[model samples]
Each structure stands twice: as structure tokens, then as C-alpha cells.
Target chain A: MPSVDNNASPPSTKKPLYEASTQFKNWRYSPDHLAHIRSTLNEAAVGVIRKTFEAYEPGSSSNVSFVTADEEHLLVTFYIHKIGQLCGHFRFPEEVEATAASYLKRFYLKNTVMDWHPKNVMLTALFLATKTTNNPISLDAYTSHIPNTIASDVLDLEFLVAQSLRFEFAVWHAHRALWGIWLDIQNLPNTPPDFAKTESAIYDSALTHVRAARLTDAEFIYTPSQIALACISLVAPDLANQWLESKENTPIPESRVDIPPRPSSTAISASLEAIRNMITNSGKVPHVEAVREVDKRLKLCKNPEKVVGTKAYLARKAEAEKKAEEKRNKKVEGQKANDRDPFGQELGEPAAKPGLVDYDDESDDE
Target chain B: MDAVERENSDRQKSWAKEQKVGEGTYAVVYRGREVSTGRRVAIKKIKVGQFKDGLDMSAIREVKYLRELKHQNVIELLDVFSSKTNLNLVLEFLDSDLEMIIKDRSLVFLPADIKSWMAMTFRGLEFCHRNFVLHRGFKMTCQVITPVLRWYRPPELLFGSRFYSSAVDIWSVGCIFAELMLRTPYLAGESDMDQLKTIFRALGTPTEQEWPGHTKLPDYVPVGQFPKTPLRDLFTAASADTLNLLSKCLLYEPRKRLSASEVCGCCSYGSPLYIIPISSPFRYPSHPSKLPKCSTQMAPRPLEEVDGNVDMAGTGPGVKAAAPSKVKLKRKLTSPADESRTRSIARKLDFTKQVNSP
Candidate 1:
């Protein structure tokens, strides 16, 4: 018989509430109002950006970066993290996250991190980005995300962002750039050292960090590529730096020394600085406490070696795998139980009863 | 009954009771009475189903355009209502049509009265023409003659061309003017073709030389071409000034036709032909007892009661009856050949010829 475990954790319930509260205090409002403010602000910002871009560079070529295999996994990780944050913060539909990611990718094609303030641009891009993607959240919903206290002030700021970008909502991301580079690299022999493995690891780690960062308003300050680079550096610093350095084709220039050698470190520092400045300027220490929780998780991944292949890692992995297996078994058993319930008879016997007996014995010995 | 038909029947019955007017093809014009206020009104009930597929096109066009048209002289469409089965059009009730006045042998309009009617006709026509609406169906029947004998129609309308301009109304006005003078229809053709021939005979058949676009008319045909007859030949008895104004209005080419506003300006009551002395013996009897008690609020009563058999009533003198008979004789003596020629001429002036020609 299937184990009736309705008590199992309802995924996403706690996270969204936590996110909503955090977002509310920071914006200083309830969910309903904040959504409207966020939506309005987002719309105004995107409109400004679109107009600015078109005015400055009418028919300008796209500025996309080519990625290396070592960087690919890290970029993917960053995008995953970003998607998580979007899901958590805005409580957006999955489709919105997908659309935002696509916009980030496309934006990167014609724009570099240095071209505009990624912080302002990314938000504008996201705001405008919703239009092309099906199931758009309203401008009111976006503006409502803003804190009630400074809501009026933020309205103008949002308009400025939109005007700066000339209303172009589309964006590009490093994940696609990484993929393109990977495809290109496949044609050549002599793979870079630990490139594939490091990339894959970075991909996993970056995803988690990006998701966490998205909830914190880091997107307002950092470009998608910078976020991606930071996540990669956090997950696999050596590989990310090597990949970046290789593309630069020069020794660490003296001028760029202050800007951390690793992309992930630079990205993290930028995000941290932005958050710290925002907290200090807002004069609200209580809000910082909530942000600290996010900061702690970010720090764990910030120094990846602390978590990599540790007992904690293995334990977490094992537990996750076991839970997944149990879920599959439960589904199968439920189907069988439903079928047998009609006749009041048991169907197939439990497979490998011995495996359970052995596990029990092992638990007893421990 | 089907759902739609039953609803329509219900609407028709209700509107008939409400407006208390007669039914038309597209609408049931009713004499409405506001239940609370007891104010009398006219309501026209339009059926929605009947409007599908250009069937209700004329009504729709009238409503769409007339909704914006606010004029004193023109009939007013007061309000509209709609239901599942019918679209209701409410209009102001007028007393009588011009045909009633024109056919009323007892009512011999003074020249000044005719002039006033002509002036009002032009004013209404001018407003319509300015708004780019052709009163495609202007006729004595459509014209609600006010308490006076006014030339309420134009000539182009009398000659049946639905696609005509304000010139059509001007043409009807010309016909009304002629009717006032002769006490009969100027172009009383039996059919559309006959009407055109009557117009052509009186106005003189237009040639390609005289009317540049004559042959280009939709119904234009190369009949054995006749020479243009001078205006003098048709209205030989008409005053010179009246003839000039009449000739201008009767231009075959629409562009050459006098505008309604121009007619208002040019055709004066002070003109010799229209200046009848007040002492003239042709005056209507003043006694209400001598006349039928007609209701101005209701739609026109039957013609026989109002105009026909006026002599039998013996309310008027014998001289009035003899006057029309003598006028009819004068018309017959003028031309038997012209009448026969006009009939053959009408046969050649088919509307289909115009439609097919261009």
C-alpha cells in the first residue's frame, strides 16, 4: 500500500511568503500595493531605456560575448539562480522567468556590461521584456512592488531607466553565449584543462546563487553577464578566471587589478556593495537583517571549497536522492493501490523486500 | 412560432399599440404616448432580423446619418430603442404630406405661398447637400407639406436616380413649382422611364453638345438623338424671370444645376410671376365649418375624404371645379403629338440603360 504522506512539505509555499515579506519591508508595503508599484516602475524604466538605446545607436550591431567551455556551466548556474530569485521575489509565473531569461540573453548580444549600468538596464529590460513573452504582468503589478515610503520617488527613477534604454525590452544571457562557445570549441581539438567538469560544477552552483540573488534586488545593479560571471567564480573561481583571462588574451592589466581577478568575485562584491549602500541610504537596519539571511546563503556558495564534496554535501545529496526515489515509489504504489481497492485485493508484491530489511538492519547497527 | 418571429410579432403589436401609427416594410411608425407624462410621440419599430444583408441598409444608413443631422425643415428622428427582435426608430409625427396639398383642389396656393414653400425646400435641401446626403427618395409622398402649399421637393428626385446628388431635390422643387403653376404634375410619367421622357420633353432632350457628360450618364443610350428644344418652347407662358430660374434648375448636367442655397437666394417672392395681388379673387374660404375638421397630429387621412370629390361636398363654388377642368383642357390642347412622343421617349429612357451604360 502507498504511504499516505500528505504531510510532506508543500514546495514553494514558505519560500514565496518569506520572499513577499522581505520584498514588502524593503519596499515598505503590502503585496498588492507593491506589485502595482513594481509594475509601474518597471514599465516606465523600460520605456526610457528603449528610447535611449534607439536614439544613441540606431541600427547598431549586437555586442554578444563568446563563451568558453569552462565558463558555460557557471553561466547556466547564474541563470538558474536568477530564475529562482525571480520566482521567489515577484512570485512570477514560470513563463515570466523564462521570458526574462531570454530577454537577458538577447540584450547581451548587442550590449556589454560596461555600455550601461546593468543594474538599471536589467530591470528595464525585464519590465519591457514581459511584452514579447506571453502572460505579461501589468504595469500596476510591477509598480506595486516598490516600497510605499519612497514609491513616488521611484516612479521617476523607473521612468529614467526606461528612457535610458529606449524601451528595448529584449536581453541576452551568458548561458547562451556559453553554449555558442561550447559549440564552437567542439570543432577544435585540445580541450582546456578541467574545462568541462568545472563548467558543469559552476553551472550547478551558479544556478542556486543566482536564484538567491534575484530575490535581493541585485538585478537592479548588476548586468546579467556580471551576475553569471560572479556565480561561476563562486562555484569554480579558478576555472572562471582562467576562461575570462583566456578571452582577454592579456595578463591582468594593472588598471583592472582593483576589480577582482575572478568574474564571480567581482559580481559578488558589486552585488554586496549595492545592497549595503541601499541599506545604509534607506536608514532601515531592520530590513538588513532579512537581507543578511540571503547574504549568509550567498556566502556559503561564495567560498565553494567549503561545501564542495564535503560530508554535508554528500549527506544532502544522499538524502535528496533517497527522497526522490521514495517519491517515485509512492506514485507507483498509489496507482496500484487504487486499482486493487476496487477488488479488495493486493496486486504486485513490494519489490525487493530484502533491500528494506537490509536498510533496517544497517540503521539498527548504527 | 420561431423565437425571432414571435419576438418581432410581439414588438410589432406593442409598437402598433404604443405609437398607434401604421406599419411600413422596415419599421412600424407608431403614435407614441408617454405613459407617465401622457405626451404624444411617434415611434417607428425596426426589426433587427430584417436588417441582415443590406435589407435594412436603407434604414441603417438613415439612422446612422440622420442621427447627426439636426435641421428645422427636415423630419426629426427623435429616439431609438432595440430588443431581441426589433430596432425601434422614434420620429416626430407630421400632419400631412405634400401630395395631399397638391391634390387638394379646394386649396389653391397663392404665388407667395408657393414661393415660401420653394424657399423652405431649398433651405432643407441646402443642409442635406452640405452634409453629403442625397435625399434619394424625395417625392410629394415623402414631403410633409406644412399647413401651407410649399414646393417641398426637388426635380432630380422626381426623375428616379437613387445615386443622384442634392440636384435631385432641386429637380423635385422644379416639379413642385411647375405643379403650382399648372395645377398638375409637370413630369407625371407612369414609370421611371416615362418620368425621364416627361422631363426630357419639357426641358428639351439634352444632347452631348449641351451636356458634356450626358452620354456618360449611367443610363445614357444613343437613342435617335433629338435636337435640344429651347426653354421658351416648354414654358412659353411662364414669366421671363421664372423661366430663367426654372431653366437653371433643370440643367441636365448635375454640376450645371443651381444649388439649393442659390435657388433660395435667386428665386424671390417679389418677382412679377409670384407677386399676386392680395385682392385677387382666388382666396380660400375662411370658415372652419366649410372645411373638413382634419387632425394635424395624426398621419394623413384618406385622400378621398381630404381632396377627392370636393365638388360633391358642395362647400366650394362651381367656378373652382370648372377652373381645373379648363386648365386640364388647355394642357391637352397644347400637344397630343407631344404626349405620344413623350411616351415613346420614356420607353427609351430606361433606368437599366443608365445602369448598363456606365
Candidate 2:
């Protein structure tokens, strides 16, 4: 038999992993990526919370609806804030945020606002953030601050979320290119320590800008590298300017008069103008105070006091276990009832079966 | 009353007369009598619980295809009905199958008789092939020898594999033809592998060059490489006309094998219906309805004053008397060579024992 050339194409331009007739085509996303995202944002921290509240006061009455809506909104906002906090805490590569955002967007594509609570969705987003950065957070600690009701459906929802995304979780972020540029600057001969420090400041400032941009519509459109660069240039222009000034002041350590000089202030100013135009056209910049406040509240609420402590935690844990036990019992009872009434008697099987079978048999006999 | 109640009542009326005939993988065929019409029918009962995967689409493939086949040679499907627990298929009852006749060694056929049987078998097979049905399990058992023993299988069917097209049925026809001539199975191996070797010994082993896609067959493997043998060696005692027809039917390549219609055209023997009347001892009264009309008309025989004391040995010019010397010669040349060669290949085929037969 002739051997097929499996490696004829490069990895970047490989064909679809699944065949056309495969059932995976029907699935929302790749199986593995869906699994990864689901595990990270287990429904225990998000799904059950919404269900519990909905069940506690079930009705389409305006008051009930309004209350649920308010709580849901608060929960979603808290999740977004926590994501921002994780962004700062982990010093996650800018790509991690972009990856996390993409996961959240893709997850919601198949899912509805009503099906899974925003809380679990947020926790999953954060969990994905950790993974995208190559840093995994334990599910135990991740769900620790979640209310028992919210935490109940976390694990179950994880699978649903993973399925929704189709498991293609490879996300590229903007910070990768920024880091590349930093590496290039570091290798340049006679680069001073202060100049490097200034450069580092510029990188930090870039991250801040990226974080701010996330709250705006611009985050939806810009790639991670573009966001990172734009953010850095916007946040800490002085540091970048100072680094350039130092280079110009302390140049010619070697007889390199023939060397091409760095770009002048005029060129730098023109480039800055172009970057500003790009950012302005992208979207309205979100308010800095609002972004910070949301970020702080997210960090604080992520580990709320109600979710911590041995006794409170155990009580909440036991409550969750009890609810799960009830649900299991209900399902088993339903199955037993179905088996006992094989003819679907609840829909009046006794009246239906005789007429259907008896007439056909007689006609055949004749 | 609702449909279910009416169906149950109808079933009860006929259920008492239902007698089991055979059971397949998913259905039980029962001999049934319609009380009102007094018509005999074969009812296939399929129980829902017996199916491992519940009533799936594949289980219906055979029923759907068979329903459309309306040829005289093919079994007719009359109706289909379903109850709460089972699906019932109503088919026209066939009296006795060809396998039972073949197994009854007491019966013997003349040369013309064998040729007529071969011709009918090919006619039926050609119809099925043109209609795009493979009849994958075309053993003697599947072929119905209506009224009496007569060959009606194609060769491709003799080569039992589900993947084949109509060519499989043609292979079974070849096997039936061999059985008619020799009064035994051409390749009666105990297992599938044994059967392949049996075919190889008689037809000679197929090489990759001869059968271009043979290597791609799911069951294909290199069993001890045997040199090819000519067809004449296998059918040494067969007449020139018979041998030519047999070789065409038993071609190794499915595409190269003669079609069912082609087999009908190539048949040297006349219609089997003439042989039936000649073989029967009863003298019939002159009545047109009593006699079946052959699709192709035969040369008219003298109707009045026909001699009831006609000689059995010299009835027709086409009929040949069985000779002991010819049988002995065939047995000596082919059977021993086939047995010894199969025994050698069987030893090499033992490695396949570990793999479970599907």
C-alpha cells in the first residue's frame, strides 16, 4: 500500500481536525476546548446560584422579575471586575485577557442569558485566564467565594461551556509582540539600566491601557498586540520619551557616526498622532474611575466573607449537597415512573393501544 | 374503536394460525393463513425488545428494497404493519427452498435438466442485478426451488460478503450449477476462510494483478501463495458449451463476470418447464389454464395421441444419460486435488482463528 503524505502541509495551514460527516460538526466547538473552559468555570460557582434564586421565588410577576434581573446584573458586573482583578494580580500576558474574552463571547453564543447565571460565566472566564497564561487555579479555591447556590451548577456548566466553544482554545494576545520588542531592545549593545527601567515602565503603562480598553467597545475589535501597543503608548509616553532622550544624550560610546540614528521627535509625534486617531476611531474610551471601581469591587467580591470560614463554608457546602440529593431522588423517581408505565399511561395508553393493534391484525388476517 | 384496538382484533383472528418457519437476526418469519381470503402468507414478526439498538434505519433497509422488487423470480412482499411491540411483514409463502432439495441426495438431474435450472437461476439473478440488489446471502438456502429441484442462483452471491454488488449473487449461481452437475457443494468449507480456500483450489487463487482491488477486500490476506490453475482442470468432465458458460459465470473479477441477462442468453439448454412435464409421470387432460405459459415459447410437442409409453432414456435429444465413468473421472481429477490443496492452505489459515468472525 502507498503511504499517504500526512505531513505534506505545514501545521499552520492544516485541514480541519474533524471529517465532514463527523458529529463534531454539530457540536458548538471542539470537544477538548469546551472541556477546558467548562472545567475552569464549573457551574457550582455560577449555574446553581441563578437556579436557586429562580426557584426560591418562581413567577413572571414584575417584582419577581425585577429582583432577579437586579441580582443577575450585579452578579455579571462582579464577574467582569474579578476578571480585571485577575488580569492585574497574575500580571497575565495580554493574550490571556483576549483569550478569556473570546472564550466568554463564544460561550455565550450558544448559551442564553437565562440558562446559566452570569456569575458562573465570569468564574469560567477567570479560570480560562489562568490557563491561557499557563497558570491553573484549583477549582476548590476558585469556587470558594461563590455562594452555595451559585457554586452548585459550576461543574455541570463547565461541560456545557466547553462544548459551546468547540475546544479550539488557542488564543493569541497582543503582549507577545510587545515582549518581543522588549527582548530586541535588551540585546542592543550599551543599553543602560535606567533606559531598560524606563522601557519596563512603558510596558506596564501599556498593560494599564489594555486593561482600560477592555471596558470599552475597542476591546472587541483590537487584537491583543495592537491593544498592548496602543495602551502602552497612551499610558506612559513620558517613560518612552525619556528612554529616547537618554539614548540620544549618551550615544557614540563607539565610533559609530555612520550608524543610522533613531527617529526624531517630529516623527515620534506624527506616529503618536496616528495611534490616537486609531484609538478614537475604534470606540469611546471607558471612564477610568468606573473601570477602577469595577475592578476593585470585583477583587473584593470574588472572595466575599459569606463564602469563606470553616463553619459558614461547611453550612453552605452541606446545603448544596442536600439540594443535589433532592435532585437525584427526583430524577430516579421520574425514571421509575416511566418504566412502570411503559405505555405512557399518563397520556392514556390503555385507551390507545387496543385500537391501534387490534384493527391492523384483523385486516392482515382477512 | 381506535386503530390499535382494531389492529389487535385483526391480529387475534389470524394469530391462532401463525406458525413459526424461521428466525433471522431481527425477525421471526411465521407461516400464516388469511382466514377471510383463504390466502397463505408468510408473516415476518420483528420484536422491538430483541433489537440491541431499538428500531433503527438499517433494519428497514432490506424491507424497503425488497418491497419494490416485483420480479417473478424474487420473493414478493405483500404488506407491512406495526403494533406497539412488534413490526409485522407479510410476504408470499414459498413452498420449499432449494437447499432442502440439494440436501436430498436421492434426486438426480439430466444434462438438459441441469442446464434449464442454470438458465432460470441466471434469469432471476440478472433481474436482481439490473435492479441494483446484491442479494448478498445467495446460498442454496436463500433460493426457492418452487415445486421441485432446479438451479436459480447467481455466482457473485456464492461469494458471501455484504460489501459486494449484484456480482455476489452470480457467484452463488455458479455454486448451484456445480451442485447440479456433481450433486454436492462446489466449495463446502466449514468456515469463511476454508470456503475461500475451497474456491481458490477450484477456481485457482486470485493474484493482485488479476484482481486489481482484491488486496483492498476487508477479509483479503496472503494465505500460502498458490499457483493459478486453468478452469478446464476444475470442470474437466463438463461439455464444451457448459464449460464456456461456467467459466464466464465464475470469473474472479466481479466486473468481468457475466450479468444475469447475459447468463440467460448464454444458456445452451432449453427452458426448465419442458423438462418438468417430461419428468412428471402424470398425463394431463388437454386444458390451456392447467398449463403455465413460458415467457419464451418452446417448439410445440404433439398434443393428441402422445405415447404414454415414451422411453425415459431417449425422450429428448438434449437429455443425456448419467455415466458412472464421467462422475469417477471428475471426482478423481478435481476433488482430490482440491482436498489436498485446501488442507495445505487450511494449515496456513490457522493464524486467522484468533480474529473473531464478524
True contacts kept of 2: 0.01
In candidate 1, stretches whose alpha carbon ends up further than 4 angstroms from where it belongs are A1-366, B1-19, B34-39, B51-55, B143-164, B223-238, B265-358
lDDT of 2: 0.44
Angstrom error at residue B220, model 2 = 3.5
| Residue A77 in candidate 2, Cα distance off native in Å | 44
Cα lDDT tens digits, model 1, A144-190, are 67444232332322323322322232233334334444443333334
lDDT of 2 by residue, A81-105 (tens): 5565656665654555656655665
TM-score for all models, in order of appearance? 0.35, 0.36
**Chain A structural similarity (TM-score) per candidate?**
0.29, 0.45
Each model's DockQ score: 0.00, 0.01
Candidate of highest lDDT: 2
List, residue by residue over B48-160, the lDDT tens digit for candidate 1: 35322211223334453445444545555555444334555555444344445556676655554544445445555555555454453334543222211122223333333
Off by over 4 Å in 2: A1-366, B1-16, B23-25, B56-58, B142-163, B207-209, B213-219, B225-237, B265-358
